[model samples]
Target: MGIGEHVGRNLVTKSKWTSVANVQYRTRRAGQPFPTAGQLSTRLITEAKRTAERSWLGEVSAVVLQQSLRDAETAYRTFFASLKGTRKGPKLGAPRFKSRKDARQSIRFTANARWNITGSGRLNLPKIGAVKVKWSRALPTAPTSVTVIKDAAGRFFASFVIDTDPAADATRMPETHCTIGIDLGLTHFAVLSTGEKIDSPRFLRRAERKLKKAQRERPASRRDRRTGPRPA
Candidate 1:
């Protein structure tokens, strides 16, 4: 978890945005005009920037604070689009206050945030400094943005947005077959149209068998403890 200039066990900026979103929602329901695009861009984010300049919020990157409002803008747009039936997916209700106990919390940073990878192969965030990471794979291109997320298990994750390389993408394509059908099942992992049945590794059953064997092969002292010392 990262909070502004520090990588720690808190999400201060996300918590603040939740409060801002909740206030906007409640006021709207109380007959106030919903925020206009002009207001979102000019007023809300501007106020946030100003607040950062004069307060502890300054520890957060200016772009990070700005991006939070951009997210709020998108949320309100999606909500109204759903209300007007223009959005394709299921209807969306008004933006709700994010729960502190939510299993996941996330914040995004754009190119303007000035984040980069250090020469020593660590993620260098604008305010939080360089952080070590285990690379899943090398990035194909320079990332345009990054999102930092904290999960309920106290693990932090960073996701990067990068442009796709057409040349590299073509290299990954498998040779084309006309078509292949695959049916997934329990006993077998999958059955393919080419008559290939991939056997499922019954890991759970294997573990259970091993556990039962361990229990049955227990020492005499363990057996004695279970049967109340053989009635003596």
Candidate 2:
């Protein structure tokens, strides 16, 4: 299945949890004993599996659905904590429902999901096939899990949680009292305290010049216009 479908299934699962929370709140307000968090959590999972138009849930790993629900549970827990003035920082409103129209979408896969990199370097996801990846850099250690994220700008990224040994890191790190000051400016990229000058990258200016040159070479779109129909 496509990434979009995976995200859509997650959103549907998230919405279901929100609806269940609202229902439970209403029951409590009506002077009836609402099901406890544990009860609702278990029941909701079963309900979500049998929910119509949600067979796609079975196609994806159960972790995705569970994480989305856990997210909702955490939101509500935080909201209640805020009301009681137990949660630090500013007060928070109740959790909002997830919408398909939202530009950003994400799904995380923990170690339990068994997602990993193949010998050929393709990302192998559960249910989702191996996807060709353009790795930015080499990983220092094996990632515990990966979160596939699509941002509002339509950019896709795979974020990883890498657990490294603190002792190893300390051994690798060298102790030094040396310090350097950097001054950033528009004219020059940076000036170091050691009197080193670095020229500005001017990346944007270079791209703009190339774009203008291409525009000059290409013919205008207006030239292809029919202009009230051609000569048959």
Q: Scored by CA lDDT, what does every candidate get?
A: 0.70, 0.80
Decoy 2 TM-score against native: 0.74
Clashing pairs in 2: none
TM-score, per-candidate, Cα-based: 0.66, 0.74
Off by over 4 Å in 2: 29-41, 181-232
Instruction: Put down candidate 2 lDDT per residue, 142-222, tens digits, no spaces.
Output: 999888888775677898899999999888889888999999988899999999999999877997899889878876753
* Per-residue alpha-carbon lDDT of candidate 1 for residues 93-137, written as tens digits (9 for 90 to 100): 876655567787777778887888998889988777788998899
| Candidate of highest lDDT | 2
